[model samples]
Target: MEDNIRNSDRAPLPVGLYPHARKVGGLLFLSGVGPRKKDSKNIPGVELNDKGEIVSYDIETQCKSVFENVRMILEDCGSSWDKLVDVQVFLTNMKDDFSTFNKVYADYFKDIQPCRTTVEINALPTPIAIELKCVAEVSS
Candidate 1:
């Protein structure tokens, strides 16, 4: 399809109404993905307190889960991890999580080396620690 909206069964369901990714020309633009899995509200690596506030989270776990979500969307759109051209990362606490996030990121992207930006945010729609927005070249 020249233009397509894609969603992957293997990936977590999006938090909003948006599709997982959209394709135009030879590129796929992935929506921001978080650590929450399909049909589950519990975020991986996140521990919530009794009042429903975040107590603790594992950045590495969130990073890995987000990467897997992105990969699944890319593949669903006929693309692959190596085809990623850019990634935008959002963290609830950059200062606390950056180091761990970077280490985990390197494990997955050391060779692919897609352009990336990490920013600190106050919060996400859900009680997750990290989210990723990605773009990749779609293979023909």
Candidate 2:
């Protein structure tokens, strides 16, 4: 069976129309998660204009917040951090933000390291600096 976690009170709502996480077979797929606060428009480490264009950002802070969102989703879905198998990271400025974001990422996954790929992009749907889309194995 396939299941979707949408608009979950345990995690921040996705900025776009999408599920926070979806389970198919024995794996869970998380959507590209940004650092937006739950039930609020504020984004950590991001300065947005009235039109929601990014003005400035701190990658480390944003990365931490994104992981926190992922953590919440994992917990609610009967999974754990160590279950993560892969992660895809999106950064607006790889040359400038990669190191800081990597450090923050290592702090969380120090031992349970998940395979990761990072890429730089010109923009995201929101004014955030980073997004994390990942897959995890679920113990059924």
Candidate 3:
């Protein structure tokens, strides 16, 4: 069974053609969530050119925002940080950002400690430095 949580104000709305989160088979799968705020086009740590390429970025700031967004989504969906089982992090510049990203991530997940996979990517749909997608057990 699948249930879509699309009307959530806790997390930012989907930035593209997708729902914020969907519960299927007792697990909540979240879309790739960026650091952009709801109802706005600004990315917290991103400085972009007119062409949408990165001019500069602050990975630590982006990491904090992304995790907070994910946390809010879980709360709104009746879950919590401890319920998260996995996370996938996509970084535009792992070489430069990984250490900062990792530090900020530890600050969030050091206790809950979800399994995570971090990967380097060329870019995301937005001009942000990082994006996070995760899965968690759906609480009753």
Candidate 4:
């Protein structure tokens, strides 16, 4: 089959012009999924100061939300969490958030341990602290 761009009505809209995922051959590549819920401006664990800057955030909460968001996109694209082959995790703060994020990630990925990479980034398009890019195998 040809490459098909996929989007989920239940997932948060992308910050930029992009679909939720793209299906090519037997693989599904997901765009970066953040912790924002659909139609909501508030991030899951984000706390902003009066100046609209991040004050404090909960990495565990953000991690769980992001994982669920990835799952939503995968399921919407005819895939499942177990089908994930690779995961690229982006975090704004590696020193502070890595341990918490790793714990949460371990819970979700313990059984379905896919190849994973975690990196620190300056920021995402949104105010979210965590985002995930995933690749999953599409069952024929």
* Candidate 4 lDDT tens digits, 102-137: 988999999999999999999988777999999999
Q: Model 2 lDDT vs. the true structure?
A: 0.83
Candidate 1 lDDT tens digits, 12-121:
88767898988888899999999887778788899999888889888888888888888888988789999999999999998888999988999999999999998999
Q: Show model 1 residue runs off by greater than 4 Å.
A: 1-3
- What would the TM-score be for candidate 4 when compared with the true structure? 0.95
Local distance difference test, candidate 1: 0.89
Q: Estimate each model's TM-score.
A: 0.94, 0.91, 0.91, 0.95
Clashing pairs in 1: none
Q: Clashing residue pairs in candidate 3, if any? A: none
Candidate 2 on 16-93: residue-level lDDT in tens?
Answer: 677878887788888888898888888888887778777788888888889999888887776778899999999988
lDDT of 2 at 130: 88
| Cα lDDT listed for each candidate | 0.89, 0.83, 0.83, 0.91
- Model 4: runs farther than 4 Å from truth? 1-3
The alpha-carbon deviation from the true structure for residue 2 of candidate 1, after best TM-score superposition, in angstroms, is 10
Better of 1 and 3 by lDDT: 1
